[model samples]
Target: MKYLVGVLLALIVFNASAQEEGGLKRPDIPGELMVDVGFNVWTSMPGGLERRTWSSKSIGIYYTKRKAFSSKLSFNYGIGLGLEKMSLGDSSTLASAVLDDNGTTSTDDDFVQSVLIVANPESFSKNKLATTYLDIPVEFRFHPLGTEDGEGLFIGAGGIVGLRLNAHTKWKYDNNGETVREKTSGKFNLNSFRYGYQIRAGFRGVHFFYKRYVSDVFKDPFPSGESPVMTTVGINVTGF
Candidate 1:
């Protein structure tokens, strides 16, 4: 994660330096620096798994090149880094479930082959799963009445493809009158790739966006149509 952040910072610095050196013309080829803050809601979650809406959130940072087709239309594409956290509720946590030798479900075995949401053995003040992704976003945008220095009323439709970078669970609790924090990192059967549709509209530097992923959050061992689907609705801040 640190490496990825460092790389992104380097790219930003390089871009700024190039602009300062007059290597790029801002008005001729516009770009956007955007930040997304959103709430995550899951649909079709398996029984026993629930998420807290307020605590489940996502943040993203992106830089995109805007290629204008005309005064009122453009195509944009970018790369971004996303941080997502899901806070599980109902005193529940995710665990690895096992299957028997015959490839049938069994709770008593030691083979960790699938994911299961189970009650935590002890109460936790914080219990959450977090993931990181490298994302590619592409969109078509329309600016009505035209844009003035990248600020105006506009609407866009886009799609994003994300490649999973990491996944883990974290817990914070009190044990023996002392605070205890535990973190475990694993694949956890999470989908390695996800694609989604995005719709955004707003004026000036603030925008509203809604995103929904058609793919499942988990892979095999989870039956078709039984896994969680992710959706996000939130605000976007752009142009610095």
Candidate 2:
């Protein structure tokens, strides 16, 4: 009898949440759970060393609920795991500079510099770290055209907040026509936090997404005393 009562209480909470303003949705076929995977290309730098941008991909699953007051407006949120892999651009200028990684002098000729003007790796290719994060997204979706009876286009705008989990760096070089790998301390801010905002448009289950970063990859933009801005372009696989 106690077990039965507990089950009943759980059902009541679940049902009430599904119907309330902030809650999950009723299990149905038409709902969308998005999975996003794409690459980010860094455009310009604070200093001006052009390094090859690598691939950064993320996967997230969102549960959506359309409001009864207006089917055109809805709310969605979910969790995900993300990874960022960065490679520095090989340059004589960058290779020649001396870098201070947390007060350690590294003359390895490949130390990417996170600081500037004072003597650190070039701004573009310093600190090649692959960082991991746990992400949570909250979005408000607007459907303008399609009513309940037909298909229409919708737009979603919102932000994502993430917590950093791990970070590392990989050093790759050619050895007698063969590849060699060395691991270095991937010392970087990794932001302790990662996040961005996105604008999306789509019809039905497919949507196009443009996400922009609002937070800096590092706490200090420059060791030299300057600010840096980085951005990327991507598409949402599960769409809007």
Give candidates' CA RMSD values in order.
5.0, 10.9
Score each candidate by Cα lDDT: 0.78, 0.54
Candidate 1 error regions (>4 Å): 1-30, 97-110, 221-225
Q: What value of lDDT does candidate 1 attain over all alpha carbons?
A: 0.78
Whose lDDT is greatest here? 1
lDDT of 2 by residue, 25-52 (tens): 6644454446554555444444544445
- Please, what are the lDDT tens digits per residue for candidate 1 over residues 29-130? 357677788998888556566677899988888877777787788787899887888888646677555545685757554346577665655677898889
> Per-prediction TM-score, please?
0.80, 0.62
Instruction: Give lDDT: candidate 1, residue 25.
Output: 40
> In model 2, which regions exceed 4 Å deviation?
1-32, 46-49, 53-69, 92-128, 147-152, 175-178
- Model 1: which ten-residue window has the lowest total lDDT? 20-29
